[model samples]
Each structure stands twice: as C-alpha cells, then as structure tokens.
Target: MAASRKVAVASVCLVLSLILLQFYVTSLHKELRAKILRAQITTFMSGLISLACWYLYRRLLAENHTVLACPSRLLWTLWKSVVICFLLCAQVTYATNLFFITTDPQWIAMVCYICLGTLIQLVCCLLVCDLIEIGLRVLRRGRQYQQNQISLKAQQTRTVVAILIALMLSARGLTVGLSPPPLKKVTIPMTKLPRSFDGLTVIQLSDIHLGPTVGRSRLQDVVDRAMATKPDVIVIAGDLVDSVVKKLGEAAEPLKQLQAPYGVYFITGNHEYYTGDVDAWFDKLRSLNVQVLHNEKAILQNHKQPEDTICLAGVDDNTADSFGYDGHGEHLDKALGSCDPDQPIILLAHKPSCAKRALQSKYNVNLVLSGHTHGGQLFPMIIAAYLVNPYYVGLYRVSDHAHVYVSPGTFYWGIPMRVFTSMEITHITLQATW
Candidate 1:
C-alpha cells in the first residue's frame, strides 16, 4: 500500500508540475504564439531526456547483473518519476521568477529553489554513475582477451560507492544550508606606515541576504560573532538584505548591536536595487546608525597624531546603471574625491571586478573588499563562476599597489545550502609597513 501511495503521489506531482510549466512559459511569451509552441515542443523533448536517463540506469543495472527484485525495481522507477516531477517544478518556478520578481520570497518559492538544487545534485550523481559504468566496461573488454568476465561483486561495490558519494554530497548540502557561518580571520599589510592604526581589526559582513532564508536569528548569530571579535571597525561590503525593507525590516534589527570604535559602514549591492526602492534600505540602515557610503570617502584620524590618517571609501555596485537607481553604480573618482592621493585607502565594492577598476584608477586604494560571487555557492557552479570573475574567492593581489579579498559570502543566496564550501565572516587585521 505504501509503494502504491508513493507511485500515486509521484504521478499527481508530475502532472501538476507539467501543467504549471506550460502555463508559466505560455504566459511569458504570449505575444509570440509560435515561440510558445516551440517551448511546448522543448518541454516534450525534456521529458524524453528524463525518460532516457531512467532507461540507461535500468540497462546498466541489468547488463551488470545487479538488477534488484521486481518490487525494488518498481520502487526505483517511482522514485525516478518523483525526481522528474521535482525538476519540472523547479524549472517552472525559475520561469515564473523571470516574470515576477517578488518583493518577498514566498514559502512555495523557497521550496522550488530547494528542489532545483536537489535536481542538480541528482544530475551530478547520474553522470558519475555513467562514467563508472563506462570504466567498468572498458575493464571488462580488456579482460575478455583472457576470456575471464569481471567480478559481479566488483561491479556491485562500484555502484554502492557511487551511491554513497552522492548521498554524502546531498548531506553536505543540507549541513551548509542549515548551519551558521564560522568566523575566518585574515591579515593584510599596508605600504604606508601608520603606527596608530597598526594591528587595527576590521570585521567584514557581506552578502548577508537577510530575508526568508536568513531571518533575525541568523543575523543575530552573525552580529554576535562580529561583536565577539571586538573589531575596531566593522564594514558591510554589500547585499545586506534580499527582500524589500517593509517585509524584512525587522529581520535586520540585530545589526544595530554591531558596534565598533570607528563605527559600522555600508555600501549598496546589486540586490538593493532588486528590492525596487534602494532609498528605503539606505534609510533603514541609517536608522541603525550604520554609515552609508554612497560614492564618498571618510578619513579615520589618529588621536595621538591628528595629522596621520587613513581613508575609507565605498562605491555603489557596478550593476546600478542597468538598475537605473539614483546616485547608484561605481563612481570611483567621486568616491575618492578630496582624498589625498598618497593616503592609504581601503575601498569597499560589492563585486570583486571593482578591484581591477581600483587598480586602474589614480587613487591610492590599497585594498578592495568584496563579496558578490558567494564563492560560486555550490559545486560545479563554482567552475562556472570562475569564467566571469577574475577574483572568485579569497585574497588576490590585483597589482603591486592594489589587492582584493572576496569573501565567500556570509550566507547562501536563493537556496539555503552550500556544498563543498562553508559560509564565513571575515576578520581582517591591518598591519602597517614602514
């Protein structure tokens, strides 16, 4: 009865997912009926591809003489069908997102993102299985010259190992998604000699994504960690919140507790524009006493020697122009305006690409801190992120005078998971070089 119920559930989910997928695609391209028809055809092709994956799995098992009992085989097929249903739902949700970028993510939307992540994991496992099978076949053909078949036990062992690896990957995804980020300490050296600011610690919290996935408690955890470090200065590189100010205003309340001797600073990230009103978030952060650095600079003066100083500057996200928000986007010259060219400056920009810009600029920007990439967020995707980002993660020296450190994000983005990567809060200690 349980098996039958599982099959029925899979069938229902598959049908509903298909209906939603068609509706979303049709809605998006309603003006072009021919394009909609082509999308429907593509959807049919995707179904065939899923069916082919299952067929290959069955054939591989049978060829290796590792086929399970009738009931077990039936259960396996039902599970595969359920996975297909999940993939369909995920694709539909992504399609819907393109049309309707909600101010706040709904629970259903979160589920879809999770489903999408699981589907990708499943695809990776399938690829591994195929590669293993191909390797085993090559070994079998080689042994055929001696007229000896490969051991069935060996084949079974390979299958078990592959499945175990896949399960471990899935578990890792869950672990990263549910856990709080650990603190990572980093030290940077500056060329200009400033005895007073030496050993000054700066705690960086970037890509917090304070929203449905990351709630008040999560932000509080991050704040507590930052406070524990007793930083002289605190900086939020960007991506403070994912949702609109109205819906997630209270979620960021814990940020008020994030105090530092030099005060907390913030700059705009591309996500700020996505919330529809950049000003609302800016106002909200200001209310918390967090300094908003909108294309400007502030000098940290040394008390003993008032003339000795270090400049801290920040620019808007590079995407601000496409977003069309007022007073937004990277304006390096405006941000460094009035600053002494020889003064040691630390710059904050959401995307690491800004490091290259800082290197080209005449301003004496010693270091640039960023966190837009999230260090690829998950496996295989990291490989894709590398193609676009010159500095994907960790500290990278852009030039002799300029260096960039890209944080692996303090939290996950759309999906509440991290695989093969851990979330982090960075503590950068500055040491002066004479």
Candidate 2:
C-alpha cells in the first residue's frame, strides 16, 4: 500500500513536470497548443493503462471465483509488464520532450502509435516470459531425465539451488550497478590465416541488452566508444538486449550509428527466440546495414574485394525447438554442410556449447563468437552458464584449431543491475595466416 501510494505520488509529479515543460516550450514556440494537448492526451493514456490493468486484474485473477493456486499470477504479470512499459515511456518521453520533438495530435496517429508501441512492448514482455517458462520447464525435464542416475535426495539439491538463487538475487542489489569497470582485452594468434587477411583487426562485442533498464543514451555512448577504435570489422556475437523488440526502436538506433567499412554483423541470442519475432528483427537489422546471420549465412568481402574473401556462418539459438525447417537452429549440423575448406570463415553461434559441435564439423569457420553467460548474470549463476556454455566468458582454444570467444552478455535481463560485469564493445584484428 505504501509503495503504491508512492508510485501514485511520483506519477502525479511526472504529470506536473510534463505540464511545466509544455508551458516553457510554449513560451519559446508560440504555436504549442498541439504539443500541450498531446501531453495531456499522453497523461490520459497513462491513466487508461493503469485503470485497464487494474480492471483486468479484477476481472481475470482477482475476481471472487478464481480457482488457480496463484490467481495473482495474471495481475502480477501485468504489474511487471506495466512497469517495463512505463520505464520505456520515461526514456522515450523524456528524450522527446528534451528535444522538443513535435508531438502529433491526429487521433488516428495517436491510436496507431499507442497500439504499435503497446504491441511491440507487450510482445517483448511475452518473449521474456516465454524464455523463463521454457527454461524452467527444461530444467524440470532435465532433472527428471537424470532422476534414475541420482542417488542423493532431490529435495536436498533443490534447497541448495534455491538458496543460491536467493543469494544471487540479494547480491544483485549489492554488487551490480557499480560503476562497471573497463572490458578485458587480450590478443589471439592466427597462424594459418590467408596472407591477404594478416593483421586484420576485428572488433567483437555482444549482449547490449537495451530496454526498460539500459537505455539508448547509454548504448550511444558505448557505440561512440567503439567507433573511436576504428576496428577493421565489427561483430556482435549475440544476446544484445536485456529485453525485447519494443525496446528495439530506441536501443537499435544507437547501434545503427556504429560505422565500419567492413560492416557489422549480428546473431540471435536465446532471448531473440523467446520473442517469436526474430525474422522481423532481422529485417530491421538489414535496414541499418547490420547483417544478421540466422542459422544460415552471409558473405563479407575483404577491402581488396578481389584479394579478400571472408565467409560468415551464423547458427540459431539452441532452444529445443528452434530449427523448424531451416536446418540451421536445432539442426546445426546441416547448416555447416556446405562450408568451403580453403576460405577463412567466422561463425556466430549464440551459446558457447555449440563450440564442441563447431569444432568437430568440417566447416571453414575458424573462429566462433558467442555470448549468453553475462558471466553468469549473477554469481554462482555463471557456474550454470559455464556448465551449459562449453567456454566460460572470454577467448579460449577449445581445440587445436577452432577458437571460441564468449562475451559476458551486453545487458541485464530482469535484475536491472550488472554486478561485476561491464558492458563491452570488442576490437579484434584478423591476420593473414599462411
């Protein structure tokens, strides 16, 4: 009750701030009536969203005749979803108001904007929820799968894991969000690269996670920092957003600004699969010249064009049902069936576990870039990432030939904190090996 009151008070203050800003802007630009009305309309929209959520809860889960064990699940889900929407609004509205962007008042435009924005955001929420549910389900299945092999009591392990989860959540409020430190840098030796590709600097970065918590301004700063290095080629491994497509418009704009002649490439992290809109996101990336490698492929020509040829192979996120008919996601073996043995190739797979398969395959890809760990996203959690990801965060010689680099994710998922992890923009150089 106290927290709700506090939020209500804060919301009222936000409305007042909007009004004050409107009055000030009107003084500077006299034809500000439309802007003023737009602010008022947005306020009304906020109230409607709040009320609609409340009514929805009352009708669905909070009603008198509920039978579910946790009827509040529906309400709680909406609550979390709304919080994310409002946070995004805070980011977008503040930026718009600061720049004095013209606010449109056309009823149709307003309706369409609201519908699209809400749908995009809701889709992202649904995406996150789906991944969580699926992960939990998988964990359950994995536990049952090994039940016969286990000699210890299952409850004992469950209790231990539960405590660890609680500790991670608690520590999240403690160590994360610290002025994150600089990214770690190390060089990899490429002894067998083609002579034309020697001393090639390839900047690698992954897991930006832009959304309710991490915003566009922060990403823009990172992008600027990355551009300052002038890398030969920029490769975004995966898990770029902490959240969904709703945040895509705001978050992606910053990434679009990162420029390199060789080009920027991306692959989907598990989060992308959760949203069920990876194809739409791929289309969006193509618009910005960021080549997205689905389990299939794309080609990046060397600067010499004639003398240079680099192939890119991207694998799909490793969900139980990701491949569909593409022979790329789940059926990764098929995706690499047509690799060229003589040419140098770079692969983007979301998880490091794919490294084992990638290493054994007869593909041309020499280096595989991946990020899903976020270095565990929490302490003790990285253990899970390590358990799941064949490589821990950073570069590793998985074998005598294949190389794997796992990025500590780009952003946080739900905790809104970063603990010991710092967001990274990598700068790597490729060399001409004999």
Candidate 3:
C-alpha cells in the first residue's frame, strides 16, 4: 500500500511538472511576442488551474476505509472533468481569437492546442484501461476459489508484457507524429469508366493542416509527393489550410508546384469557414492556378476532346452556412449544373458524410472523395468517429453505382499523434471495368 501511494505521488508530480513546463514555454513565447499582460494572465491561470486539478485528483484518489472510496470509483469522474475542461479551453480560445481578435496567437496557441489534445488522449487511454481492469475484476468476483494462484513466473511475464506495450505505444506515437506522410497508391475499378479515361491517375491531397506545427516545409514535402505521382488530375479534397490565408499563405505557397494534365481542383472544407475569411483562401488558391470548385463543375476530356469526357464537380462544405457563410453553403444541384449524366462523374465534398447525400441526389456521381475524419486521428477515437460518421476512414460503396474514398489525411491536425491511422498522399488510378 505504501509503495502504491509512492507511485501515485510520483505520477502526479510528473504530470504537474510537465504542465508547468508547458506554461513556462508559453510564457516565453508570449514575452517574445511582447504580450506582457497576456503572458502574466496565462501564467497566473495556468498555476491556478494546475493546483485545482491536482488537488481534485489527489482527493479523489485518496484511499479510505470504505469500498466506495477506492480509486476506481472516482476515475471516470476525474477523467471526464479533465477532458471537458481541456476541450472547453481549446475551443474557447480558438473561437474567441478567430472571430474577435485581429492578430492571432500564432505558435503559442498552436502549442496549447496540441499539448492539451495529447494530454487528454493519453489520460483517456489510461482511463479506458482502468475500466477494462475493473470489468475483469468484477467478472472474477466471488470466483476467488476458482481463481488460479499467481506464480512468480506469470507475474514476471505480465510485467514484461506491460512494459513492452508501453514501449510500443510510445514509439508509435512518436513515429506517427514526427514522420512525413508517404504516398499510397490505390486502384479503383469503375464499371462505367470511359475507355479513353482508362488508367487515369488522380492524386489527392487532403487535410494538409498547415499551421505552427505543420508549416511550409511539411506542405512542400506533400506537394513534392503529389507532383511525383505524375497524375493526370490533382484534387485537394478539403482542409487545405488550418489557419487563415494571411497567416499560412507562405506555408501553402509550395502548392504552385502541383500540376497535372487535367489541372488541379480545390473545394472548401469546414475549416476554411472556421478560419473566418473563406473568400481570401479562395482567391489565394485561384492565384496559384488551383481551380476552386464552389458549387461548380469542370469537364475533363481526353486530350481536350469534349466527346470523351468526365464531369468533375465540387461543392462548399455542408457546414458552411452553419459558420454564418450564407451563399457559401454546399449546393449539389448548382455544382452539377448541365452536366452529362451518362458520363462518369466525380464529386469532391469535404466530409465523407456527404457520400450518402451525393448518392441520394439525381446526379450520377460515380465517385465521392473526402478526408475530414482523419481516420479518427488516434485510437479509440476512431470508434467514436465510426459512431458519428457514416463513412469514417476508407473506401465504401454507398450504392451499386457510387463509391466514396475517405483519405486518412495528408497531415495531423490538433493532436500530434496518429495510431492505427496514417497520414497519406493518396494516388488513385482508375480503370475501366469493360
């Protein structure tokens, strides 16, 4: 019991120390930016919140003479509270600055967002393991007579397994967070594919998420990968920018290098509206020769021969109007305007959820491409994503005639971790079934 108490104390101290280090780094950033008042406020609030969370955690974990006072009883409450607090902090800060402030917090805000998400996910994982352990114990209750006595060999084996699991998880997180995304070539066989368009190569770059953590250098690598595909068509499904155009314009400048025979196309994701000035990004992309398909359609023909052509249509994100952008909302009918229905059609919508809607529409959309879900971005959360998103991560045939491919994303978003899912540059080759 004393050893367990000592371990708990050490764990708490370690967590507190890490939080303090984050605050110190944030303070230095603020100071460098000459925001003295903001720095002071942040430091004060950090200390206060840290103290309160630690106090609550200690109280909740305290052992007592009763069964109800056990650590497992309060673990859920503690986990939920911490997660809620972190989520609130992240959203409130980002939204407040996005709508109200002229000058963004930049790198400081980025660090906080990433750190908070990482901490929350790690704690959530631990909480889940604890719940599983509790369930196992409950199942074994009253079966003490049936329970096998633990031998030293078994105990040591268990310890080794636990250590190995810890090491593997740590290594995976670091690798996924730090490594550049690799190109994944996927082939799609279309029954109605045009004979002339057979062997059509399309490169998809989605969810680049250029911000403080992911910047020009990373984006350049993605661009290089896309270019290397030597694709006939290049499409940026959505989420090309994580921040406002003014802030990440230079970061996205490498996109000029992306070229394809059929030209490059882009559609706005929900993040575009969230960045506050969606129009600015549209203009910027257009200037870089990226055709913005906002309720618009473009026909791609075989070497400019209009008779052998396929229609490529794109719509604004479904959530555009929800972000207060009225005319910028997704309009499938308008995007599919005057398109040849017999010809195979491809639709680019930001969210994979749009696949069902596309299939429901009269438009003969042969394929829908998307990338917003990020394949859940981390473990266990993928389960949550599955619950919410009809099409969360990969390819699915929405109907006999229509299919949707949800890219895992070209980069990480808020949390600097990817487990089970990968950051990928998707290269899709289309073949005619006939």
lDDT of 2 by residue, 269-356 (tens): 7656544456667777787778876766666666675655766777777752432313236446555655566667678887777766
lDDT of 3 by residue, 1-434 (tens): 99999999999999999777656544453223223333444566556446544532432233211312225646756655654565445434433333332222255555455544444444454455456555655666454544444222333344334434644664576578769888888888776787888999999988877664577777777788788779999999888776677777777788889899899999988767656567788899988999999999998988845578889999899766544355678788898867787888899998877767877887888999998998888766788877888888778877777789999898877556687778888999988876
Cα lDDT tens digits, model 1, 125-182, are 6567668777766766544544233445445565556556755776688788778888
lDDT of 1 at 299: 88
Model 3 deviation from native, Cα RMSD in Å? 12.2
Best-to-worst ranking by TM-score: 1, 3, 2
Worst-scoring 10-residue span by lDDT in model 3:
61-70
When 1 and 3 are scored with lDDT, the better candidate is: 1
**What is the lDDT, from 0 to 100, of the residue 192 in candidate 1?**
81
Candidate lDDT scores, in order, read 0.75, 0.57, 0.71
Q: Which candidate gets the maximum lDDT versus the true structure? A: 1
Candidate 1 worst ten-residue window by lDDT: 29-38
Error of 1 at 188 (Å): 0.7
List candidate 3 segments past 4 Å from native: 1-114, 136-170
